[model samples]
Each structure stands twice: as structure tokens, then as C-alpha cells.
Target: MDERKLPSPCVVVLVGPGAAGKSTWAGERFAGELVVSSDRLRALVGAGEDDLAASADAFDLLEAVVRQRIGRRLTTVIDTLGLDRERRLRWLALAREHGMPCVAVAFDTPAAECRRRNRERVKRIPADALAAQLTTWNRVKKELPGEGFDEVLQAATEVRVVPEAFVQADAAVRREDAAPRGLRFGLQVSSYTHKGGRKTTGEWIRQVGARAEAAGFDAIYVMDHFRQIPQVGRAWEDFLESWTTLAYLAACTERVRLGTLVTGITYRNVAHLGKIVATLDVLSGGRAVCGVGLGWFEAEHKAYGWEFPSTAERYALLEDALQVLPVLWGAGNKGFSGKVLEVPDTTCYPRPLQDNVPLLVGGSGPRTLRLAARYADAANVFGDVTRVREKAEYLKAQPRQIELTHLSTTLIGRDQREVDALVNQLRPRNQDPARYAATANAGTITDQVGRFRALAEAGAAEVMFSLPNLDDDLSPLDTAGEVISAFR
Candidate 1:
């Protein structure tokens, strides 16, 4: 679903038995032009789809189309049994020759299930042929990983092993009869593009903030990162400093709150973070939510010359930050001593405009959740509705109230057609569109309404979402506002 994974513009050979749901899988994820089906070709050229004399012509046409598509570096889904090792190797070689990544999607649908469906099909293959395909599938499933394909994924699971990628729990889609109430929404701007030229970037950022506020967003946040994070974008892309951008946004928009999605506790002096948050609060009329987390990106820390501490040490630093931020923003100077911080004097000039600035912890670990429950006002966690349900159960059990918030990267399209277009535009070439759509939580406006309603029912009091297309423009914010309005 993210860039660190193998996605698209590659040759995908479907490796499965008949009635394994191969074509059905491909049709849901791929466009007609992207899938080259041998059976379909046979049906077109022969007495019928099951015609034996047209087999040679069907395969020949399949190879010709695969060659042309690979030569052009376009994504192609080969809809065949894919049991022929020699044919699979040929396709792999063609992809490699064209500098494209070749993937083999082996369906894991059980043999019994295949047979059940095959029995139901009007044009079912002969039982012997089906049996042979199943035998071959059993052999090929074990061989796929060692084969030369870039990745071999089980079509049943929309996920493959990837670092830092989140696979959402399968939550049944159901809309609440009544709209949700008291659920807040915010927009987190993660990717910064240079598409509009360097000079136009500031204006674009302002528009994003203004549009988000107009769209009924309760707050607007930007990722506190020195470089573009790999999960969202590549390095060397445009990344504005977090607090300055928040200051600019605070000036551009009124009423909407401002904050960083999270600031790395290791990035700056703990006391300095308090000063920064305090200043933003005053300038933004008390609309500041300071999100802090144990910093983990060592590459950026090394690049910026900030010492990236061990996990324990980072948590220690975060604990001290959470304890001291309040004291620093209070009336009198105070001394604080903790695991990693020893502030002799917390003399902060120009105290925060709010009596108590809302501190939101941005991590989902048990220790982090406990820390939030003990000290922070709110906790922003990630994962699907199931994980949210688990975390919500834990946090709610605490003696004190801890607000629950969620960060979901949602793809909101007006309808299924627009959703499909964005899927084609954003999903990696090899990724199945249906899986990517589910992974991204991509859907129409009504679907998003139901999606957020599910999140709310799972105990998310507020949901901060980012649009896939918001990296360049504010087009979707207005539509997103409609979802926000439903909750209000």
C-alpha cells in the first residue's frame, strides 16, 4: 500500500488453478486493458471459450500482448493458469529485460473451494483438467518464493511483509442509521510537493489550512519531520519545518486549532519544545495541541546531528517532557528533575494563553498508552477499528479520562468511479486495486461516512485523516467537510 513495497508497472502472472478466483480477483483490482486473459482470448477466437483448436492462437496472442506491454513498461496481469514454469520464466525474463519488476500472485483459495465453484460454473473444465491444475498449484505454491519474481503474494491476503506498513483488520462495512455526533476531525498534511514551483508552496500550504478550516476541521496538523518520511514520501522531497508552518497556518486560518501530528522528543531540547508550544498557543488564541512521541527515525537524527537515543532512553526523555511542559507554561518558575531531564529553572516568558494546553501523546505501545493515561489529556493511535477497539478498552479502563483519537489515511472519492480513478492513479502497479482500496480505506463519500462511524463506535472521539491527493491541492477538503458535517 505504501512506496516501500512492490506495487505497480510490473508484470504480474496469476499462478493458480481454475476456479481459484484469479480472474475475479484481477477484474476487481485491474482495468480491462491491464489484464490479458488467455481463456478470454480463446473464447474470442475459437468455437467457444472451451474450444481446443484455438488454444495455440489464444496463447500466441497472450504472449504477443505480454511482450508489447512489457516492452512499453506498462503493468500487465497475465490471466492464465500460470502453472507452466517455462512460460512463467519467459514472462519473467521479458519483464527483467525491460527493467520491470515481475510479481507472481498465487491464489491460496482451497482446492475444495475451487471444486465447489467449478461445479457451479456453466463452463466448467473437465474434472481431470481441474485435478491436474490443482496438483500443479500445490507444487507451484512451494516454488514461487524461490522463483525469479520480485514478490510472490497470496491473493487472499491484501498484505505482504513490509516494514512499518499497517494492515487494517477486516471490519464489516456497516453505516449507522443515525449520524455520529461530537466526533472531531482534523487534517494532517504529511507530503509536501514541489509541483507548483518553490515559491507557490507557501500559498498552497495556506490554502490547505484555510480549506481545512472551512471544511469544518477542528484542527490542522503537519508532520514534524526534517526530511520526507519514507512511509509517506521519498527523501529529497520538499519538507517544511513543522512549527514555522504551524505559525503560518495559524495566521492564515481562524478558529481551527494547530499543532504538529507529533514532534520527536529527541529532535530538540525538552525545554525548548515547551517554549515553542507555548508561543504557538498564544499566537493561535489557545488552539494548540502539543503531540509528543519517542523519536525513532535515526537517519534524520544523524543527518540533523541530534543524538538518537535508545528506545528506553527516548521514552525516558518523553516522560520528562510530558511532566515539565505544564510547569514551564505555568506562572512561577519551577525546578524539575526526572530520568533524563534536570531543568533547574522553568522560567518561560509569555505563558500559554490556555490555562492548560492539551497534550496528546502520539504512540500506541502499552508503555506509551500508560504514560498518556497517567499524564496526557489525549492519545492519538493508529490501526484499524479492531486495534482501536482493543486500545480503547485499555485506555478507558484507566482511573482518569484519556481522550481517544485516531490517525487514518483515508482516500475519499465522490463515487466508485472517482475512487477507481484515484486507485489507478495512486496504487502501486502490482498491488491489487481491491486490496489497495481496502488498505487505504478508499471509498465514496457514503463509504467514508460509514467508515468513520465505525471508528467512532470503536471509541475514537476524534479522527484525524489525510487525503491521498491533498499533497498538491485542497480539492478534497470541501468534500471531506461533508463527512465532518455529518458528525456535527
Candidate 2:
């Protein structure tokens, strides 16, 4: 086959049983394109020719070169014996990460022919090595596409290529069937310690809960912290325990689900926290979501006299909290003992209404992703659609089903002049007025309708908007009502 005429956006992997003339054929076939050879890299690095000691360095250099060339839209050929799944996956990830297509070409020449050709070589491999190589080759070929290859090619002189487009198409079908079809929305009603003398009183919470439910929001989320963020104001203004306020909201709002945007697992024991969430979930008729995270605010810990561990230790506690919560909520009531936490067998009353109330974790980190995979029902990310999509892809690899909810600031106006007024009012909170002004005052109601529809298409299960303040006179409830009415 002419290498230049090969498929575009594809990774063509050359594979075969040991001594099956893979390297010889690849050298002859793709002489024009960049050829990444393990042997040449060892030779350049001063390791004995073809010595495995330099294999790691050789592959590293090979990867860098291939990535650079492929990034420039050049077709590159890898000339190593691509016999195992792990080796092939490196190339597969390179292709996927760059959004290019991939193809694997395996040499299926007969073993007798392979051995006959090997006898003609100057440095011959051992028979046992060839046998083991053949065994791996057979096992990996069947597992290639599952390992993320886009196409698989089997050849014994004449090549046979199996298109993975059907698999991708089937995946699309399954996604459509399994995806949440209902309209879902959430709101952030952060409890603020009033500016100078005002308090975050029970009345304010009731008003916000009423507004959220009246505006047709699906859920009401409160911020979690011991003290108010200093950037907003002083620490002693009026801060309330997030869970305690959530309990109040649970009784006040019958329709809108109430929960924290995220609660720190640092201060509370995991088993006790699980019991609290379970009680709230049962009281609220399964309308409570437990949003947990590793504590971040150091000042809050100092203010509240709670011990703040190192980040690594906090992550361990976070993981322990996630593991123990399920056991506490489910049949396995035996206490959990981990490096960070120990819970004795003690049953709590009023198990959650839903067999499993949703566990929502907030943050964008590798450990967070793994935890979400193991325990989270959803992840709360604060960013644009592109960033949300990236997080979603990472979360998809985890074992749990994770929905993504993105938090953004929204300003709605009845007309252009009202929009301008709202933008001015919000200028103090935003870092860059011009950028936020564009997002807020981009166009008419028709434009915002289109924007929200696009967000839904981009895979956001819910988009929670952060309002300025209750007394700010710019109601997010009104804005949400308008958007929901227009879209629905």
C-alpha cells in the first residue's frame, strides 16, 4: 500500500506474531513518512544496539517526535513490534487526545514462514521469546479496539481492515438512549454574612427558598464553610452551619431539592456526616443531595478550631468519607476503619428516603475524579462548556455514573437599557467588566434562548446561576423564570 495515500486522521499500527516480518514490511512500506524505531533510538543513546536498557528513553524520544510530526498533520509510521495492548494504547491515546482517527495493521504471516525468515537474520531472537510474543499478539489483537483503537487491520500480504465507525455509531445510539431527557436546573443561594450589621437570618433563607421554588428551579444549593469568605466581608458578620440551614430549607421548600454546593469532610467524622445526610434525605423525601469535598479554606479551620491536615491527608479523608458513607447508608452497617477515619458500628435512625440519595462532589482534580468514579452521582464544576466537557470525559472512565452541573453568573434584563443597568450593578463583583458585559448583554432574549439550548446540547445536565444578592433588586428567579418559560 502507498503510505502517502493512507487514511487521514488514522493511526495505522503494524503488528504480527514474533519474527513475522513486521519491521521489514514497515520499513519497506512507510519509508517516506517518519519511522519511529526502537533499535535506532538505543543505538543513538549509546546503549548496546537493540538493548532493552535504552528502551524507555527510546520510546520517550519516539513519542515526542511522532507527536510533533502528527501535530503538524504529518502521517507517521511506528516500526516497533506492536504486539501488546499497552504499547498500542500509547499511540491510541496520542491519536484520541489530538482528535485524530487510528488504524492498527497486524501482520498475520504463518509461524513457519516467520521462523524461516528469522533464520536469515544476523541477530536472531530466542524461540521462547518468539513464542511468548506470539501468545501476546493473539491476545491483544482481539482487545485492540476496546483499548481505544479506531480501526483494526489484519494482513497476510493482502490486508483486511475492520472499520470501527460502526462501534462509534453504536456508542452514539446508546448514549442517546441512556442520557437524561428531562429539563434539569439548579441554583446557588450562597449564605452571605451580611455586609456590615445585617445577618443571614432565617427569614432570608425562607425568602430565597420560596423564590427558587416559585421560579421553577429543580434544586437549591448553599455554599459550605465555617466563616464567610473574607473577600466578601468580615468573618464574624453572620455565618450559619450549611447543614443546619439545609435542614431549615428542607422544611420550607417542598418542591426544590435542598443541599450544599459542597460540604467539607474535614471537620466532621465520615460516619456521622453520612447519618446527617441520610436523616436529611429521609426528611426531605429523598430531595437532598450530599455534596462533599476536601476542605480548602485554611482560615475557616483556624477560626472554627478544626484541625486542618495536609492536602494529601485531606484527600485520604475525603476518600474515606466517600467509602464510609455508602456503608453507613446501606446494609453494611459495620463501621469503616481507614488510614484517616475509624467508625464503630452504630446505627442511625431514619435511613434515606431514596435507596441511594445522590452524592455530588465538587472540584477538578485527579483524586477528585477517582473519588467521583467510585462514589459521586454528580460533579459540580465552575467553568464554561468546554471545560465541563473535558471533566465529563475524565469522569466517564470511572465506575460510577456522574452527571455534570456547571455554575456560571447570569444577568437578565427586559431590554437593552435594563441589561446595561444590571451590568453596572454587577461590575464590583466581576474582575473583567468588558468580558462579563459581553456574556450578559450579548443579544436579545432570542439569543439567550439559543445559548441555553447550546449548553444543553453540549452535555450539561444542569446549569446553576449565581445571583448577586437578595437585596440587590436584580432577581435571578425572575431571570430563570423567563428563560425556562421561553425554552420549555
Candidate 3:
């Protein structure tokens, strides 16, 4: 048998008569929790798995479990003697209702093999019953292709899930306009609510910077927020101010640049932001990047007693700031008069140490992209591979070309099982795993490599993503290095 893969977060129905190796095949390929077996349910409810008297209750429990798993958008394998058309139809309907692909894995064992295996079982079905199942299986096999299954598969030696990103990933890898300038990966630390508490934050930040730098990360970015945002955590969780912490961290690590994933344009006066980032650059020996954006999170603004301006007002302010920031950082003292702001005197001492401070504009909106193209060295955006490619095209259309980058909240694992577990930890209240995976950009390290490679192919020069487990773990740094290595 050759190696084959199926999509994750999908439904798989095993089709076979008694003792046709369906159970063994499913057991070999899937984790125990993902396989919903009627026999196991019977063992709990009845005298034993083979007890005929408990069939109705066992089936009832089985249906309930299957419905729940499908509702959650989890990969589920229905393990049963797959001869009942009615039951198969129910499973297919459930899979379709949830927009998951339903796959029928046909176990085509010879009748002689089935009877031989059945006779050797400790509790075999009646000889007459076995014969009846053999007859029913032939009919089931013929009807499966017509039953609206997304796929009909023959199970043999090797089978695995391809995950949902395969087609897009393949296309991204083949894109003609992929950035030819190589790629860089940056780690953005969003939360400090690890088990270590506030006392250990200083130590944790040092560990995080050191690990990322050692693992070949190009930069370590942090979020700027007064309180933990609702997307990353609750409002009250421990949150650190971005630049003050970055200033302290600048001393702890060498080589890797430190910057904010984005500093809100409304948080501070533009000149004040220039001074802070300049100091950080000077302190870190020129390893500093300044990422600014049109600030969202209106609730955070209200909580912090800052005025949350309307969207149009903010964009105007952002454009004004972009026009004057270079004058603030440049050699001469200059003042700015723009659409929304004017500075009387732009006199700041201790200019950024870098000859060219990397200015990043973080947003994909039309106006933001326009601002980035005119003033920023790079523009950051996010989406699946296809959307990312489209965004790269949009950026290319601008007269002044700037580097393309991506920003995402990442939850990475070693493989499918670990991916599932990580999703379970952060999966939202009543939201399906599939939906959350999209929100968090969840996948294995290998999955991420493929995704990022596609991003690189889409003309993105760098991928900046926040990790969910930065709270307590630095181990992901080592595994994440594999991605960095691919681009290098």
C-alpha cells in the first residue's frame, strides 16, 4: 500500500461486513478518542460488547456521540459493521449538514477471509447472521458511490488526512510572483499570563528573546495594549506595556530585533512615539523596528480613558503621522502641516541609531496600504494563502512598491493529534474546532512551513505571527526553527 492522506476535521465512515478488518484499520490510523465505536458503547451499557440485548441503548449513545463530534467539526471515524444503509445515510447527512467531507472507506476482504476471522473470534456472530452480512456488504459497496459521499476510498496499508490547506498550499508553492528575496520569520509574544506569574515575567521575557534569537527568528514582536484584548485573553489578564518591556528586553538579547506587532497610532502623540522607539533602537544597538497601525479595539480605548475617534478620523490622523514621522526621525528638525495634524517643532534628541529605521505599517485596508506604500518600508497583512496572494497583487499595483509581510495568531503542533489538543485549549465557547483553527491559524510545524512558504511565494518578505503558548512554554521555539530553516 502507498501513503495517502485525507483532509483533517472531516468525517470518515468505515464500510465492511463482519470481521472485514474495519476496526483494525481504523484503530491503526486514528487516535482512540476520535473513533466512535458502537461495540465500545455496548460494553459500557450492556453485559459486553457482543451482548445483543443492549444493541438499542448502545446505538442510541453512539448516535448522540457522533452528532456531538460532528457539531464540533472534529475528525470522527464511525466504527461499526457498515451494512445498514439507513445508518450510513444518517452519518452522511450529519457530515453534510456541518460542511465536512464524508469519506466512505470500503474494506474489501474475501468472504473466505471474513468467515475465517469471524470463527476465530471469542464471540462470533451466528453463522446465519455472518452470511446475511456478507450479502448486505455487496449491496452496500454498490450503493456507496451513489450515497453522496465526498469520496469513496479503499483502505489498505497507509492512509492519512491531507488537512484542509493542501490545494491552496500547492497553488501557493507554484505561484509565479512569489517573492524572490527570500523569507524571514518573526515571533510575536502576545500574552504573559503563564503559570509563572508577574514575578517571573522579567525572566520569561529574557528566555523568550533568547530562545527566539537562537532558533533563527529574525525578530521578536510584542502587542501594544492597556489590557489583554478579547481575542488573546480576557480583559483582566496580565498584560505588559509594549515599549517599556522591549526596552528592558533589549539588554537581555543580542542580534534579534525587538518591536511591537503594532503600536496604535492613537495611543500616543506621534512625536512621543518617535522618541520612545528611537531610545529603544539606541538601547538595543540599532536592533529596533517600529510597527504602527490605525488602532482598533475601541473597548480598550474606552477602558484606558483614551478617546476612540471615528474610523475616518483615525485614518486621517494616521496619514498625518506617516507624513511627519520621517521628519521627526531624520537629521534636520522639521515641522509638519497635514490633513489632520500639525507639529510646531519636531525637535527630538538621540535620533534612531539605524541609518534607516524599518517602518512597518500593519493593516490591509485600502487607505492603510496606501499610507504604507508611500511612507513605510513594509506592509503587514493576513489571510489564507489565496487571500494573501490577492493582497500581494493589490500591493504591487501601488506606484511605490514596499515589502509584503503577514501577521497571524498561530497555534502550532508537531502533528495532527497535537494540533487537535492545542485547538482544544483555546477553542472558543461553543465554536467548532475547524472554525477556531481558521481564526488562530492552527496547524503543525510542518503545516505552518507549507503555509508560510506559500506566503513567501506570494511576495511576502516576512511572516510575523503570535503564538498562543508563549505564556509558559519556550519549547515551541526549537520546533518552530524548522520553518526558519526552510526559508534560509
The top-ranked prediction according to TM-score is: 3
Q: CA lDDT of each candidate?
A: 0.83, 0.67, 0.84
Candidate 3: lDDT of 92?
94
- Per-residue lDDT of candidate 3, residues 301-321 (tens digit): 988799999999999998888
Q: What is candidate 1's lDDT per residue for 149-253, written digit by digit as tens?
A: 888877864422111121121121233444335688989888878378678998898888888888999999889999999888788988899999999898999
The per-residue C-alpha lDDT of model 1 at residue 66 equals: 92
**Per-candidate clashes, comma-separated:** 7, 5, 4
Model 3 gets an lDDT of: 0.84
Output the worst ten-in-a-row residue range by lDDT, candidate 3: 172-181
Where in model 3 is the C-alpha error above 4 Å? 1-5, 31-33, 41-47, 53-74, 86-90, 157-163, 166-181, 420-438
- By TM-score: ranked, best first: 3, 1, 2
The residue pairs found clashing in candidate 1 are: 7-428, 7-429, 7-430, 8-428, 8-429, 8-430, 9-429
Q: Which is better, 1 or 2, measured by TM-score?
A: 1
